[model samples]
Target chain A: MRNNDGNLVFERTPYISGYASVVGKKEGEGPLRDYYDRIIHDSYAGKDTFEQAESELMNTAVRVALNKGEFTQHDIDLACCGDLLNQCVASSFAMRSYAIPYAGVYGACSTMALSMILSATAIESGAAKRAVCAASSHYCTAERQYRFPLEYGSQRPPTAQWTVTGSGACILEKAGDSHNLLNHHTELKSNIPPSSGDDPLLKENHRESQTPYLHSARLGRIIDFQITDQNNMGAAMAPAVVKIGIKNNGIKHGIKP
Target chain B: MRNNDGNLVFERTPYISGYASVVGKKEGEGPLRDYYDRIIHDSYAGKDTFEQAESELMNTAVRVALNKGEFTQHDIDLACCGDLLNQCVASSFAMRSYAIPYAGVYGACSTMALSMILSATAIESGAAKRAVCAASSHYCTAERQYRFPLEYGSQRPPTAQWTVTGSGACILEKAGDSHNLLNHHTELKSNIPPSSGDDPLLKENHRESQTPYLHSARLGRIIDFQITDQNNMGAAMAPAVVKIGIKNNGIKHGIKP
Candidate 1:
């Protein structure tokens, strides 16, 4: 993590507080606890559409950033955020509160990661000083907008993860220690050879294995970063990740269960 | 324009079409021209907000891109667009119609330029081959949400530009050489003086000047791409054409105005 001193850089790990969520529009004792004291619940409840709710959520994130950072509107150099909306209305509406120079970005659920990436780039490029990167997924909101609604009772597979109706926001400060954004690394594992020598040359092996012989002939490829399944994100992404990682690392066998 | 055969590179020039505006509850005819056949009427009429209109307009743009580019639902690599809203609702909602992979972007009114920049980057990075970059602004919608009602008729300074309530979308294809995104040379003129020219005589001369002058005695500084008076982007952008023409071995700036 390199701080550009004048702009926001990425942070691998930083102190996090004020997490909030609007899943199912939960009213009490839920993910929105962090927002209970500061935010007005009715502010979001009165809206008729998901778009309105998204805008409200983004504004809430900005308010949180301002409060947690102990900085006023003037101190912020840029507001960077985006989501899966038609024209990035959530971000644009949120920016209305303050006149901070801004840039909106998108990358699906990967938006958070992409924001961090661009925040790092902008900081490294010295175009900004302090930046905020945030994203949200409103279940009731996203569902009605993206797929079938909750009322539709659409059957989903166990492999699929629930779409989280929540928002996450973080601030990247330029004056922090060097390890803000994690460095990009490229490395991979080697293929493991079959344990048995010459495949035993047995008549049973000659039969081409009537039984599916468990071959531990390959090592699973791994990425360096701490990998946590982002629930549905994992399954939706597993195929692509496995394909790339296995090929790049020279992993000889198929993906492990 | 160099075509790498479906490989996304940079373009040389492209035409813009299908522009429309909806200021307040009234629709403007400027955008409903040869290119535009659809008009997005607000559902709630006066109650129709910027977030909603912007989404509708962007959706129209995507539809236009789909029809004009002869692309199917799956053919679009990504949807890249953004607006002046707080949370980017416009791009997100508009993206729901097409099941194409998408990435929202924002740079305010400069959003077209910004999205174009990212589209170029995405194409160049091999992350996408075909990308659609679009942006929209709703003056009445923005005013009601951000500032005050347009009926208030507040006096704005000459430097202030009335936000145009319109949307524009462009489909960037790795196709024919005739259709390319052009690059223009940027220049800036500032009323700042050179540091090296600061001297005792210059300082005395500066004090005697009618207009505010620095000790360096310079009229202005010429920068490569910092367009000042950007409050009027159309006017400020004029010089770029001349500069680009000269740089690209086209007609020179034969006579200065």
Candidate 2:
């Protein structure tokens, strides 16, 4: 349902049934490394080109997510995916192996959020029974395409942000249907190596009531501060995020901001 | 609603309220040029870069479409746009001036159809009241990014396809809402110079009964024939098109293909 402030409150909330993530060596060494399902030690991930490596990363994530959900590509109604590459080649190439209907999306740094929102909307609207969403960005590919190549050894500005060579995918299904599926398939398997002993999905309560559900989504409007510095994308995007946050807060409290 | 064959059949159909197109000089010389609302004589479109020129083309088309629909950006619930540029920069940059919630999509040659389908689904689901969908491509931009720079004077193969420098935008609204708005605003103005004396929107019957409405949309699955020749994209894409066509025909005749 559309709210007065333009937020969409889904009467039939869609829930995330399964998810998986893969990261590069640099990201594997970070603090949140244990949360990822797989980590590739090689930058190329056995691929000749960085572009191909990114596609492989996305493909692996999608496959693992499907395995975690105990559903194959034939069960999915649609796939929404994107990447930072030109024309979103990584996503297009990765999705080619799967016969599911697809929609390619682009939102730069916010691609993950964008894909999830679209997937949720599709499920909530009864347009699809299940949807898979994925997004990826490779440091080597992004650096050369959007900035100076790594081979050039260009000096980085303090404000410049590093792009992660990583991919994440999730399977979203209707809440009611997710419960039925969980009851039918009790033997869950992790396609990738488990990062820790406390895998959340393994917990008894987690399978019962802890699966995350999407309540509502507030789409963002484009806001520009006229910042010309390409190195300072954070500044260009902060204002828009702030605007959405304030509006969301106002809506929660039933007050006009 | 989801069909047995994965096609979406909208019970509450969405109708096109307005649309406009802009083309480059080369396209203006074509036979169907009169259908376009405006044509840019300059290759750069008075912009400093070819990328910006493409963005300008898309922005102009969007504005003209809104004007024809007798609506403003505030009336739109969402904007779905995409282009051939890396990271979809053309669409992202073009949509920044508007405050409408935006979703950037990418589907290579099928971006236009993809955007329209998503928009129709959003309106049909009641997630959005109105939507604006657009797609754009520039000859110079695509030539340099995807193949070779124009300055290189590269030779073309027989199977190579020339990318058109053009943009089109359309406004979609709920079928019931469109009739109400059309009745309220009877005097519609064309934002760009009229190419011919017979403007379709100007006809009385056109406004009353001839407007187009979306009935159903079948999303496409990615298909690869393993043809690695970049110059022969038609060969790579034709098989997928034929598969969808055959499936659609079978569905129409109530026979399984």
Candidate 3:
């Protein structure tokens, strides 16, 4: 695919074959709570520290994702992981038990998307047959690292986005795989049924991901816009997200593309 | 490619098209000092905080690498970065100025290798035409974040590795580009002449990087042998490095492959 601004063009597209997610009590109580695979009753998840809880969450998510994909630790070709920790210790420590090749990434709240894009890129290129992309965020851990400790009981702020305790893992497989996992009504809400073994896209025999393929993406540029209020993450991230939307959707002013 | 353990072997290898390095005054005194491109007199790098200085080091390294590869931020499909600081502030702050789609990664001291491998994987996948991998380490920042403040002047043990200030950036293009840069021995001693039209790797290739390809790699597993010696990085990292050598070079025990 080509674009007027030369963005959103891809050489090879890939697919999201399998995915799993684990969330904390707060997140499970939220709007899309029904979609979560595992919802812990407490933030600690029976761990001693918030950090440890986050790590356990990630491990469980990864395990669920692997099981969903019908893969074992040894089958993970690439591991993209991160957390909101100072050095992403939660994800790193959780990966200790696995023999998967790993790439530890950091993107604050954007980490989920960052890991997904990278996983897609690797599978798209054929460097990896299966890539597990994961990220976790714990409210207590985030507070201790980025702000004040919850022990302080700081005053409420409406603009602050709650850092719900949650961990999500998604598996991306080689695009040519027969299953075409994205067709299911998962996060993206596509309802395409299983392949009949006679689909035209599959028949073409090109090395492209099946329906719901990951197309060329417009890499986001950091646009600070000098927003000093860090509490308002949506404001800070709006510019980049809008840029991506424009590039990918090519929405013209006052009109949808 | 499949191993006895089932690690996904890549069928398409990528190339290391270009690379650049920058070090602080202390590291300029090290053994491989001659290979570094720029050596700052101090860690401050004309910034108020050591943190900012570290960010500047990354920016300088990125610029140097971009110069060697003849690429602008526009050409980069993705930027993978990491540092030792909390949330990888050094690299993240540096990337604020570039338009490259970014993935901030963290692996403590192993960040450099982690970034390189991730970059190679992305480029090898063909999801990206070009990827920039970079990492930075500053003694002051590392000391403050991981252990103690530099002012503490804590007692040193033999196992403690000095945190020298340095940053490196490498550009990875699609594996088949003709420059075959790795074949040119800049640091390895010989200065291969610039590309000539007659070079075979350069011919019949629309977009293959020159020689010195990132042929293959084994993603390292986190092997915690219960060694609590934080300073003894060599022992903690030795197993993973050896595994990589055995996998990549096919070296055998008691005999070189």
Candidate 4:
């Protein structure tokens, strides 16, 4: 149901049963390197073009997520995907091999979040039993498309942030079904206590506490503060983030503003 | 709910309450010129750039649709929009002024159909009370981005289809609520017979017969026939459409193919 703050409260919470992340060489060298599932040392990821490389990254992420969840492509009801490309060709190309139904979304920097929300809604509304959400971006593609080409050797602005060459994907399923789906995965099965017998309720409760569930989502409105400087996108987006953060906080605390 | 054929059947039907279309000078001179709500004689539409002109076209379509339905910006729960530009900047720029929650989608040529299906799902699932779906494309933008620049005066292939410069917007609402929403519009009100009187049931049935309702939707999977020729997109896409069309036809006829 929609609250006064315009947030959607899911009646049937969606759970992230599996997830995977893949990054390029630069990001693999970062502090969060160990968190990723795979790292491609080459910028091209053995692909002919930067766009194809990005598509490969996303394809790897999706495959890894499905493997972790012990689910096949046919198990997924929908695939909500997008990327930072001229026409989001990365997602389309990556998903072409899989026969899963697809919906392509474009939200630039917010694409991953957007895809997750759409997936959660699909699961919550009974429109989908399981959905995959994925997003990808490559630094080389972004630089040449939005700025000077790498061969140009242009000077960088201090305020400009480097785009990461990476992709992440997650498999969302109905909350109640998580226990049955994740039972075969030994790592997750280890979370269940030996003393807790086959009482389904207790096991479900234990699994619920261990797994992450999406309870609600609040969609953001476009808030343009008119910061025309492309180099300082952080500053331009700050106001929008702050506005949404305040509204979300208010809704959580039951404070009307 | 999903059926054996992978189509979503909406239990609560969604209705198209209002719609509008806007086109540029070239389309205005076409045979269907009288069908459009508005036509701009200038390619720029008083905007400084072709990109901005495309945004203006989408903005006009959205406003005209909302105006016909007598809906203010606040009445819209969500706006699903996209375009042919890089990063879909045309949609983003056009939606920046409206405070309605937004979801940017990218399906290239299938964007409008994708948006409408999403809006229908949202309405049927009670995630949104009303949604505005809009899509736009400018010939100049498409030509410069995907092919040669307009100034180049490049030759065109015989198989190439010219991208029309236009925008279309539609508002989807709950089916039962359409009678109340369209009551103020005389054009639709005249559809009801004067003898119907105040019998609410008869009025509703009459309205249902006159209006269009979304019964079901089938999402398509990406199919690559590996046709590398850019000028013959129709040939590349024909197999996918035929496959989906046959499946839908089978479902309608209750065939278990």
Best by DockQ: 2
Better of 3 and 4 by lDDT: 4
Model 3 - which docking category?
A: acceptable
lDDT of 2 by residue, B1-257 (tens): 44547767665456688899999999999998999999999989999999999999999999999999888898899899999988888888899898889999998888998998888777755678789999999999998988898989999886788889999999987655653455423234223122211333433333566677666677787898888776777788877777774566456747675
After superposition on all CA atoms, what RMSD does each candidate show versus the true structure? 17.8, 8.3, 6.8, 6.5
lDDT of each: 0.48, 0.80, 0.71, 0.80
Candidate 2: misplaced stretches above 4 Å? A179-208, A248-257, B179-208, B248-257
Task: List each model's interface RMSD.
Answer: 13.0, 1.3, 3.3, 1.6
Runs off by more than 4 Å, candidate 4 = A1-4, A178-209, A248-251, A254-257, B1-4, B178-209, B248-257
Tens digits of lDDT, candidate 1, B1-257: 12121111233112221222333233444544434545545533333555676777777766775666566645545456777765456766666566554556655556776676555443332234466777877766666555566679865567666676566777654321112222211111122122212334433432333212111000011112444543455565455334432332233224343
The parts of candidate 1 lying over 4 Å away from their true place are A1-44, A150-160, A176-236, A243-257, B1-109, B116-257
lDDT of 4 by residue, A77-194 (tens): 8999999898999999999988898999998888998898888777655578789999999999988877877879998887788998999999998655654444433344334332
Clashing pairs in 3: A106-B104, A125-B125, B176-B208, B176-B209, B177-B208, B177-B209, B179-B210, B180-B210, B180-B211
Taking chain A of model 4 alone, its TM-score versus the true chain A equals 0.86
TM-score of each: 0.41, 0.87, 0.82, 0.88
Q: What share of the true interface contacts does each candidate keep?
A: 0.16, 0.75, 0.71, 0.69
- lDDT-best of 2 and 3: 2
